[model samples]
Target: MAVSVTLPALGESVTEGTVTRWLKAEGERVEADEPLLEVSTDKVDTEIPAPAAGVLASIKVAEDETVEVGAELAIIDDGSGAPAAESAPAQAEAPAEAPAAQPEPAAAPAQEAPAQEAPKQEAPAAPAGGAQGSGASTGSTGASGTDVLLPALGESVTEGTVTRWLKEVGEEVAEDEPLLEVSTDKVDTEIPAPTAGTLLEILVGEDETAEVGAKLAVIGQKGAAPAQAEAPAAPAPAQEAPKQEAPKQEAPKQEAPAPAPAPQAPTTPAPQAVTTPAPDPVPAAPAPAPAAAPVTPAPAAGEADAAYVTPLVRKLAQENGVNLATVKGTGVGGRIRKQDVIAAAEAAKQQQAAPAAAAAPAASGTKAPAIEASPLRGQTVKMPRMRKVIGDNMMKALHGQAQLTSVVEVDITKIMRMRNKAKDAFAQREGVKLSPMPFFVKAAVQALKAHPVVNARINEDEGTITYFDTENIGIAVDAEKGLMTPVIKGAGDLNIAGIARKTAELAGKVRTNKISPDDMSGATFTISNTGSRGALFDTVIVPPNQVGILGIGATVKRPVVVDHPELGETIAVRHMTYLALSYDHRLVDGADAARYLTTVKQILEAGEFETEIGL
Candidate 1:
C-alpha cells in the first residue's frame, strides 16, 4: 500500500509554503517520524517528518513550488506489496515489449485482488491532511442564521489583509479567542472571537484581501439550529399623498412677486435714482491685480527644485551639514536625482575642505589637541525574519498602546534549594537537565490564574477586552535565527516535574529547529529569563498580540530585613532576584500589574512543598 504525504499547516497565519529541499530521494527507505523535507513559510522554515516506514515511491511536487496545506507532495509505498503494474503505464508498457511478457499472465491473477483494495485504503489518509477535506466527509454543511462576519481589528482600518486562516469550515472555535491574523498598514494583529460557535465557512483565502463591512467568515451555533425562513414582502404605499400639498404653498409666493414690480416703477419716476447706480461700475480697478503676480513667479522654480530633491542626497547633506540649494541638478529636465545631487555635493565638499585644511594645523597647535576622532563606521546587517517581526511588534506596541512596567523583588532561595537537591536525580530519571525555568513557569501560571487580566489581550475595536481560559505559556528561547518563543500548552495543569520535562524537550527542539509551527502558537502569556547571562535585571519588550511578559533576572544572595508575624523585623540572609513585568497599559493598569507581580513573588518565597514534588 502506498501512503500519500501532504503538507502540514505551519502557523495560524501561514496558508502556503514553498518546498525548500527534499531530505530523502525517491526509492530511499525512510523510517517513520524521520525528517523528509524542508518547507519554508514567511514565519518559519521547518522540516516535515515521514508518516510511516516505507520506500519513497514518488515525489509529486518539485522543490521551490509553493503548495497549499493538504496538497500532496510525495508518496511512500510499504514493503508489504509492489505497486500494480497496470496502474503505472510507463513501468508496465516498457517491460511488456520484452521477452518476459509470456510469464506475466500467470502472475496477474495473484496481483489482481490486491489492486482492487488499494483505493479503499487511500480514503482514510485524506482526513489527516486538513480539516477542510475531512469536515466535508462527515456531511457537515455549517450553521445557519445571523451571519457572523469577520471582525474589524482597529480604528483606522477600513479593511484587513488576511494573512492566514486558523479555523476551517465546521471546526469549533471558542468565544473571544484568536480566529485569524489580519494585517493592516499600521500593524499585524489577531482578530478575536465575538461569540463561541463552530466556523460555518471560510469566505476568503489566505493572502486574499477583504473590506471591513464585507463577509470574510461566518460562525454559528453547533448542531442543528433552526433555519430562519425569509421574511414576507411588504405592500406598496398609496400614491395620493403627494398631490394634495403642492398648489396651496405656490399661490402666496406668486402674489408677492406682482407687487414688487410696482415699486420699481415709482423709482423710475425719480430721475436721480437711475444716475445713482452708474458710478458703481469700475472696470479699470482690476488691471492692477494682474501686475502684482510677477514678484511671486520669479523664485518659484528655484524653491520647487530645492523642495523636491532626492532624500538620499538630502540626508547625506544633513550628516555633513551642507546646504542643498547650492548643489545643481543634472537629471532629466533639471530635476534632481541621487547621482546628480551626489556629484554636486562632492564638489561642494571639496570646496569646503580647502578652508578646513588651512585651519586644522593652527587650531591643533594653539590649544590642547582635540580628542583624536575615530571615523564613524559600522557595517549594516540584515535582520532575520523573527528579529524583524519582533522589532516591528515592539514599535507598534509602544506606539499604539500605553505600556507600563513594574518591578518586584522575589526571593528565589527556596526554588534554588529545590533545584540544587533534585537536579541530578531528576536528570537521571527524565534524561533531561532540569532548570529553574519550570518553577518560574509554574509561578507565572499561578499568577496568571489569580489575575486573569495578565493572560488577556486588548481588542482595540468593538470596545471589548478578551481573556483566555487556557494557560499556554511561551518560554523565550534564543535560537540561531533569532529569538523564538515556543509555547508549552496547558502549563497550569502540569506539575513542576512535568513543566521541567516539557520545557527541556521544547527547548531542545527549538535550538535544533525541529519545533512544529503549531507548538509556537496560542501563547497567552510569556516569560523571558535573562538570568543565564548573569544580568541582574533587564527590560523585556512585549511580543505583539500578547498582553504581558515577565522578565526574570539572576539570583544573588543579600542581607535583607525579614518581618515575622510574632517577632517584629530582623536582619537575615536571603536570596533575591529582580522581576520586571512589562504589560500593555491599555488592558492592565499600574495597580493590577503591580499586584500580579507581587503575587508571583509571594508564590516563590512561600514554597510549601517537597523539593521533588508535583506542581
Candidate 2:
C-alpha cells in the first residue's frame, strides 16, 4: 500500500515549514526511521524520517516548497499500499507508528543487555585475530569492520564538518572513546567510537563535511586478516580517480596560460609528475583500474578534462586537438558552448593552424602546486561549521522578514535590592549563583503571558496568528565557543528561584557542549542579558520563529524623581536599566511592544517575589 506522508507539527505555534532539501529521492530504498527530507521552519531545520521501511515511490512536494502541517509530502510504497484508499483500521491506527520517527528510550534500555553482551564477547576474539594480522594486512583487511558515522548533532542540524581526527589509521580505539571532533552550526562536539577496534581507514578527512549518518571511518577487528585477493580496498582508490582526473584536465589549461606569457621549466610541473613513483603501488594492485592506460595518458594527453563537455564535443575537440579556452564562447555568460567547440574543431581542420600543440606538450609536463592555495586568505582558515551555519541563518532572517526594535527605560531598583539581599543565601541554598538576568527572564516571561502578542507567531499568507499557551523562553547564553540559546521550557511556571536554577543548568549544558537538541527547541520567546558585560543597552536581533527578543542593559545607580505626599517630587537614587525589544513587525506593532515592556517594567518594579526568592 502506498502510504502518504505529511509534515508533523514541529513545535508550539509552528504551523508550516519549507522543504529545505530531500535526502532520499524517488525509487530509493528507505529504512524505518531513516531521514527522508529536511524541513526548515523559523526555529529549526530538521530531517523528516520515513515512517516505515519501503521504497520512496514518489515525492509529492518538491524541495523548497512551503506546506502547512498535515500537507502530504511524499508517498511510500510499503508493499501494503492500497489501490484507491487505506482501510478504516489503517486510518485509525496511523498514529501508532509515529513513535518510529523518533528514538524510543524505553525500548532502547530493554535491548541494551543483548547489545552490551555481543560487543563484550567479540572483544576478546577481535584482539586475538588483530594481533596476528596487524602488520601483514596493510589496510587490505575487509573481513570484519565497523563503520563510524557522524552522529546527529541537533534537531535542526543536518550535517557536520570534521574539524580534527584524534585517532589515526592503525590506532586502537576503545568503545565509547572520543574518535574525532565535529563542528556543526549549533555546537562543536567530539564524536566517540561505537566499539573497540583498530582504526582501519579515515574515509572523510579533516575540514570535509559528511551528512548525518554518513560513514566517516572504518574500524576493523584488531588482527583481522585480509580476504585472499578479494581487493575490497579497490573502491577507495577508484573514488580518488575521478577527483584526480579533474586536476589532470586543469593542469595543462592553467600551465598553458602561464607558459604562453613566459614558460618556466620550474613552472611546468607536469613532466616530473608522470615519472613520479606514486603510480607504482596502484599499478601493482589487483583491482581498481587498467592502471597502465591511465598512467600513460599523463604525458600524451591533449585538451584535458572530459568534464563540462558532451560526448560529441569531447570527440570533435580531441580529433582536431583544439584548446577549449581558445574557442570563443557564445552561450550563456560567454560559456564555451558545445557548438562553439565543434565549430573550432572544424576551423582547425581547414586552417591546419597546428594550434598550441607545443605549449600543450610542455604544459602537460607541469605539475599543480603540491598544496593548493587557500580558498580563503593565505592561512587556509575555515569557519567552524556551526559558526558558518549560524551566519547563514542570521543572513536569512535579516533579509526574509520585516523587523523593528523599540527601546524602553526601565527602573529595576526593587528587583536589584531583592537580588542584593538574597544573593549569598540563594546561592548557598540552590548551589548556583543568583543573577539579575533571572529576574529579567521571569519578568519577561510573565509579561509575554500577559501580552500574548509578544509570544505569538504570524503566517502572513495564511493570514493567521498563533499565540502560545506557555512561555517557553529562550535565554541566550554567551558560551566560550559561541552564543547558545537553550530554552527554559516553561519559564512562566517557574518562580524567580526556579528560573535562576533552570537558567544555570541550561547555561552549564551549553558551556559543556552537553545541551541536547530537545533542550534547544520549543522556545516561544527569547531574552538576552546584554547587561552582563556592562553594556548600557543593545538592540538584539530576534531569532527566527520567535516574535521578540528582550535585551536588558546593565543596571547603574542614577538620580530619579520620587513622589512624596507633601514634597510633590524629590530627587532620589535608584538602580536603573534600559530594555530593548526587537520584534517581527508583521504581527507585533510598536504599541504592542511598548505595552509588553510596560508590563515587564511594572512586574520588576512591583518586586512581589520576596516569597519566591525566600527573602
Candidate 3:
C-alpha cells in the first residue's frame, strides 16, 4: 500500500505553497522525517518531510508547481508487495492526459512498455509495482485528477498575478518544467509543474490575480485524452500537428506583412516587395492552406490581442513621437498594443520616413528641465503581516499606557573580567557560548523582583496594573521574516548558564522557523541587545502586552572616580555600558523606571552577585 504525502499547512495564513524543488527523486528509498521537497510560501521557504520510511512511489507534482494544503505531493510505498491487478485501470487512467500534454519529450519507450504490458495482465496486482517503479510517471497521471493550486509568495502577498504562461496545454512538461510566471509583492517567480505530464488545462489567464490556493492549471498523464471537450485546445500549439500544419501555410500570409515592413524600410523597397510576394505564393500554392486561411484569421486576431504588451512599447511610442492611433494593431483583435506600435515605429525608422519633426519648443518654453522622480521615491510599501501585527500592538501599548524612558550607565569591569575568565569553561561545560545578554537578562530579572511595577502590564479600561510574580523575560531576535521575541520563562529562577542555554535554544529555533506561535506570546518584559552590534544606546519600543523593554548598549572601558567607605577615593578603570529602559508610563512612574534601571546597573556593577548567580 502506498501512503499519500499531502502538502502541510506551513502557517495559519499559508494555505498553499509552490514546490520549489524535489530533493529526492521518485522510487528512491527515504527515511521518515527526511526532507523530500522544498516549498515556498509568502512567509518563508520550508522543507516538507517524508511522513514514513518507504520507497518514494510517486511524486504528484513537479518542482515549481503550486499546491494547496492537503494536496497529495507524493506517495510512499512501505515495502509492501505490489497491490493486486484490480487497481491497474484506475492507476493507468489517472495521469494519462497530463503526461501527454507536457512540453518535455516523453520518457523513453522502453521504460513504459513494462508498465503498459503489466496493466494488460491484471489491473489490481500491477498497480503496486507500477506505482513504485517510476514515481514521476505515476505522479503525472495522478496530477490530472487533482488541481494544482497557486501559493502565496509571502506574508504580505494575499494573491499573485499570473504574469505569463510558459507552457501551453497538451505540452509534455518535465517534473520541474516552468509552467507559468507569477508576480507578488516580494518577488516574481516561475511556477513549475508538480509532476511530469501533459498540461491539460489552464484555469487562470495572464494578468489575472488569484487568491492563494486558487487552482492554476491541471496536468494529466501522457497520451491520456482530456476529460473535457475543450481539452484539445489546452495543449501547446505544436502538439496539434495536423491541425497546425494546415495553418502553417496560412500564418505566413498574416505574419508576413507585420514583419516585412520593419525589415524592408531600412533596405531597398524593391527587396521588400520581392520577399512579400514569396510568402504569398507559398500559401496560395497549397490547397489545404487556402481553406484554413479564412477560418484561421479570426483566432489569430484573438491571439494577437492576448499576447503580452509591455510598458516599454508605450514609452517608446511616446518618446519617438509616434501616434499609436494611426498604427494598426497586429496583435490578436486589432487592439492598439505595444508590439504593434513598436513594429510600426521601427518600420518607419528603417524607411527613413520620419514623421514631420515637431517644432522645437522655444528656449523659454523648456520650463526648467522637468525632473524625473525615482521609482522607489514616494512609494509606500504595505507593512508585512508580522510587522503590521507588531505595529498595531505597539501603538496600543503606547496609547493605552503611559510610556517612560530611563537611561543609566553601568560599570561592568568586574563582570567582564569574570566572564573573560570563565567563558571557555562555561561554554565547554554548558554547550552554550557565554554572552553579555545572559548577564543583562539576569540583572534585569533581579531588578524586576525588587521593583515589580516595572514588570507589570496596565489595563487602561480596567483601570488596573497587573504585576506578575514570576520573571518571564522576552528577548527580541531579528529574523529574516521580521522581529520575533522568544521568552525565557522563569528567568529569575535560572542562573547565567541556564539563561545562556535557554537563549541559545530559542535563538536556534527562531532561525529554523520552528518556534511555535505560543513561544512569541505572554512575556512580562522584553530585552533588546543593540549593544552587541556596538550601539551605545537606543530607546526600545514597549511591546503591547509587556510593561517595559531594556536596551543594552556596547560595553566599553572608561575611567571613573570611586569613593568607598573603607578606602580613599581613587580613579579606577571600569567596563561600562549605557542602558535605556522604555516602560509603560501608565504602569510605571518616571521615578520608578529610573530606580529600576539604577538597581539593574547596581546588580551588574557590584560584581558580588557574580558568585551568587553562579556566572
- Which candidate has the top score in TM-score? 3
Best-fitting candidate, scored by lDDT:
2
Better of 1 and 3 by lDDT: 3
Q: Which lDDT tens digits does candidate 1 get at residues 94-173?
A: 43432332233222222322222232333222121112322211111223423344444432233444556677666678
Residue-level lDDT for 255 in candidate 3: 22
Q: For model 3, how does the per-residue alpha-carbon lDDT over 241-325 read when each residue is reduced to its tens digit?
A: 2121121211111122233323322111111011232224224322312211132222223334343223344466787777665
Q: Model 3: which ten-residue window has the lowest total lDDT?
A: 265-274
Candidate 1 least-lDDT 10 residues: 229-238
lDDT of 2 by residue, 1-615 (tens): 778889998766567878877987776556566678887665445778888766788999997688998999999988854211222222343434323312332222222112211222223222221223221111122345886766667654556656678887678899999998876544567999989988865655554445566556778775752331233333232223212121121111112222122212111112111233333322332122221123323322332442133334445667668876577755432434446776887786656534444335564776442354655665756564345446766777777667888988888888878888999999999888888888888788888878999998776679888899999988888866567778998888998878888988988777655665577788888888898899999978888777898998889999999896999999989999999999988888899999998998888889888887788
Q: Which regions of candidate 1 fall more than 4 Å away from where they truly are? A: 1-8, 15-43, 47-382, 460-463, 564-568, 611-615
| Residue 156 error, candidate 3, Å | 13
| Candidate lDDT (C-alpha), each | 0.60, 0.63, 0.61
The number of clashing residue pairs in model 2 is: 17
